[model samples]
Target: MPPPSPSPSGRLQWADVPPPLRARLETTLGAPVTEAVTPSGGFGHQLAAALRLAGGRRVFVKAAPDDEPLTAANLHEAAALDALPPYAPAPDLLGVHRTAGWTAVVIAHLDGPDPDLSPASGDVEQTWALLDSLTAAPAPASYVAAVSAAPSAAGLLHGWKELRDDPPDDLAPAARSHLPRLAELEAAWPALATGDRVVHGDLRADNMVRDHDRGVTFVDWAHATTGPACVDAASLAPQLVLTGHAPADVARLLLDHPATAGSPDTTTAFLAALTGHWHRNARRPAPPGAPGLRDYQHRAAAAGLALLNHRLS
Candidate 1:
C-alpha cells in the first residue's frame, strides 16, 4: 500500500490547493499536513510542492494531472541506481505516490548546493572519473533493446535540416556557417554504433550534486537511456562550459580518456544534435531570468564543434 501520507501535523498544507484535493491529500497522508509551500523553481512542471513532514522529513511532490513528469524522473533514477555498479553513490529512494493525478516521492534531501561545473569545483576531474567509472561497469548489452536508442546520423541530420528552414535570426555566425556540415557527418553513422552502456543523457550542472567527501551524485534521470557513454559525455560538453569547466581542459581530458572512444564518434550528427537542442530552446516562451535563445544557439554550436575538434586533434 502507499506509504501513509503526512500526519495531522504533516499533511499537505499548500495555500494553492483546492479544498477537495487538500482534504484528500491530508487523508492520504494519514496526518494533518503542517505546511505546504511551492518549491522555488523547476523546469518540467509548475505545480511542484516541497512537503515538510511532521518528523522533519522532506519530499518533493509534483502535481501534474497530465503525467507525473517528476515521478517519471524519479523512476528513471531508481532504474539507473539499479543498473549502476553497486558502489556508485545515488539518492536513497523512500517511495512514490502515483495516484490522484500527482506523483510524489520521499527522498533524502541532498544537503549540498547545486553543482558548479567550474574548475573551482574540480568538476573537470570529477566528471572524468565519473565517466570512467560509468564505462567500467556498463549495463548489459541486451539493454540496447530495452532503452531508447540514440539518434541516428540520418535522424540527427534531418533535425538539423529542419532548423535551417527555420533558422532563428540571432544565430551566431560561427554556428550558422557549420549547419551544412552536420549532414556530411551523418554519412559516417555506420562506424559510430557501439554496445550499450547505461547513460545519463542529461548530465548538466543543475542535475548533479556533489558532497565534499563522497564525490558527486547525479540526479534528474528523465533522459536516462542505454547508449554509448561517449554520447552521455558529449551531452555534457556544453553544460560543462556553462558550469565553469574550462573548455580547453575538458577537451584534453576526453581526448585522453580511452573510455570515451567507446561512445559515438565526434560526428556531424552530434553537432546536429547540439544545434537542434538550441533550436528547440529558441522556440520556448522566455520566462524571467532565462537567457536569450541566441546565446544558447551560439554556445551549443561552439561547444559541439569544440568537442568534435578536440576529439580529432
Candidate 2:
C-alpha cells in the first residue's frame, strides 16, 4: 500500500487567513502574494502552504491557532530551523508571526521532490548523506536544552508493557505471543539513544526534499532533538522496509554505518520500542483536529513490527 495520505482537517487556504496575518506576510516578503499552493507530502495537521509573491519570491508557510498544541510545535520548528548548522541542509527561516488567532512560521521555499527510499535507489544514499551532514555538529545548545529536557525515548517506548497489563484483542499473534519478551527487550532503549548528536526525531521519506542542485534538505524540525547519532540512522531502518527494501537490505545498510555498528542489541531494542510506541498509539482515537494521524500511526506500527520481527529472528 502507498503511505498514509495527508489530512485536510487542519489545513488552511490563503482565503482562510485573517487579513492582518496576510498583511504581515506581505510585509515580510515585501510584495503581495500572487499564488498559494498546498503541498502534498507531510502530516502537518495545520496550515501549510507555498506562496509566490508578485516580485517573484517564493516561501513556505506553516501556521496553527495560538491555543492549539501545534502552536508550540510551530514555535519549536522556527527555533530549530534558526539554529541549524551552516552545513545542514534545511530551509532558512524568514520570519514568524503571532496574532490573536494564529502563530505562523515563514521559511524559504525548497523546490524538490520527496526522496525515493525504494530499494537500491540513489535517493537512499542522498538521505544517508543528509543524515551525515545533520550529525556532523552537536545540536544547538538552546534547542537541545529546551526540547531534550522532555522524557527520552526510554520513557515513551513501553507500549508492550501497557498492552500486556490489559491485552488488546486485536494484537497480532506474533506480538501477543512475544509481549513479555518485547517488554524486557525494550527496557534497554533509553541507554541506546543517549549521545551528543542532534537527531531528526521523526525522519522519514515525506520529511525529506531532494533538489538536484541542493541534494537533500530535511524539513519539519518540529521533532528535532539531541540524541545518539545512531538513533537517526537506526530510525530509518524500518522505513527502508516500508518503502520496498527487504529486512536484510535494511540490516546491511545499518551495518555499513560506522555510527550504527557494534550496537546490534541497541538497534534491536530501539526498533522494538518503536514498534511498541506506534502499536499503542495506533489503537487510540485520533487527537482532536488531526483526522488522519491514527491511521498513519497504524501503518507505521505495522512496518516497525515487521522490522522488529526480522531482527528478532
Candidate 3:
C-alpha cells in the first residue's frame, strides 16, 4: 500500500506579503502585477507564486521576511541558483530583490502542473531525466564550496542514532522489530556521502514542476549539496513509494536507472538513514507554524521504513 502524500505544513501566501515587498517585486519585474497564483506545496517560502506582469512576462517568485527561517535560506538559494551551470535543469534566475526587510528570489515560471508519480505516470521518466542531467553535470566551482560546506552543526542526518537510543513509543511493528539493524545500516552511508556531483538533499513530488514543453525543473536549491552521483536519484526513493509505487518496485526502478544502478548498499543505507530521520523527527514536537509537518514526516517515515525493510529483507 502507498503512504499518504505530504503537502506544505506552512507557507507564506501572496496576499500576506508586505506591501513594500510586493511593490519591490513588481518594480523588479518592470511592470505592475496582472495576477498572482501561489503553488500549493513547499514549506520553504513565505511566498512561492507565479506572477503575470502587466506586460505579459510570467515569473515565479519566492520571498520571506527575516523572521522566517526560509528568508535566510533564500539568500543561499539565490547564490546557488546564480552559480548553477547554464545547462543545469532549473528555472532561469531573473532577479533578486531586497526591500522592507524581505528577500525575494525570482526565476522564470514554467507552465506545467506538479509532476505525477503514480506507479505508471509519465513523470517517472522526468525523474530519470532530471537525475541524469543533475548527476552528470560536474559540480560548478562556485557552488562546490558553498554546496560542500553545509551547516549541519546539529545532529541532522535523520536522527537514526537518537532513534536507536530511544525508540519512539509509536514505532511501527516492522521498524520496532529491527531497530538495532536499522541503526547499524544507518551508520554505513556517511563515508559514501562524499562525491563531486551536486545533490538535491530533499526530493519529493512537491519540489518539482513538470512542464511538458520545458521538461522538469528542480527548485529550492537551498538544500543542494555535493554528494556521490547516485545520491540524488537515490534520495528520491521514499517520495516515490509515498506516491503509489511499491517499495520493491521503487528499488528496482532506481536499480535500473543508469545514474543509480550500481550502488545497492549505498541505496539501502541511505534509505535507512532517511527512514530513521523521518521516524525520529515525526514524534518530536512540531515546530511553530507548520502543524502538518509531524504528520507529513510520520507518513514519509512509514514509506521510507517500508522501503528500508524491503531492502534489508
Q: What is the lDDT of residue 198 in candidate 3?
A: 74
Q: After superposition, how far is residue 73 of candidate 1 from its true place, in Å?
A: 5.2
Q: Rank candidates, lDDT, best first.
A: 2, 3, 1
Worst 10 residues of 2 by lDDT: 1-10
lDDT by candidate, in order shown: 0.54, 0.77, 0.76
Q: Tell me each candidate's TM-score.
A: 0.72, 0.89, 0.89
Per-residue alpha-carbon lDDT of candidate 3 for residues 1-313, written as tens digits (9 for 90 to 100) = 2211223435666666778888878776789988888777765436778998898888998887777678767777777777777777777778888887778888878889878888778888878887887777679898786654556411356567777687767778898888888888778778666777877777777788887687777777777777777876876877888888888888777778776777787777777777888888888887765656788898899888877766777
- Write the residue-wise lDDT of candidate 1 on 1-313 in tens digits: 2423332333322553444555665566666667556433234333445566666755544443325344555555544544544544455555555555555444544545556677776765776677777767668644444344334332332334555656677655554666565545544443554446666666666566675556687766556666555666666766676655667876665556756653435433454455455655555576433334456655665566565555434
lDDT of 2 by residue, 1-313 (tens): 2322334544566666667888987886799999988877666667788899997888999877787778888888788788777777788988999874888899888888888889778988878877776776677776577565445545677688888788898888878888888887787787677777777778888887886678778888887778777777888888887888887777777777755675677777887888888889999877654667788778778777777776676
Worst 10 residues of 1 by lDDT: 3-12
lDDT of 1 at 243: 59
* Pairs with backbone N, CA or C atoms under 3 Å apart (clashes), candidate 3: 158-277
Error of 2 at 294 (Å): 3.1
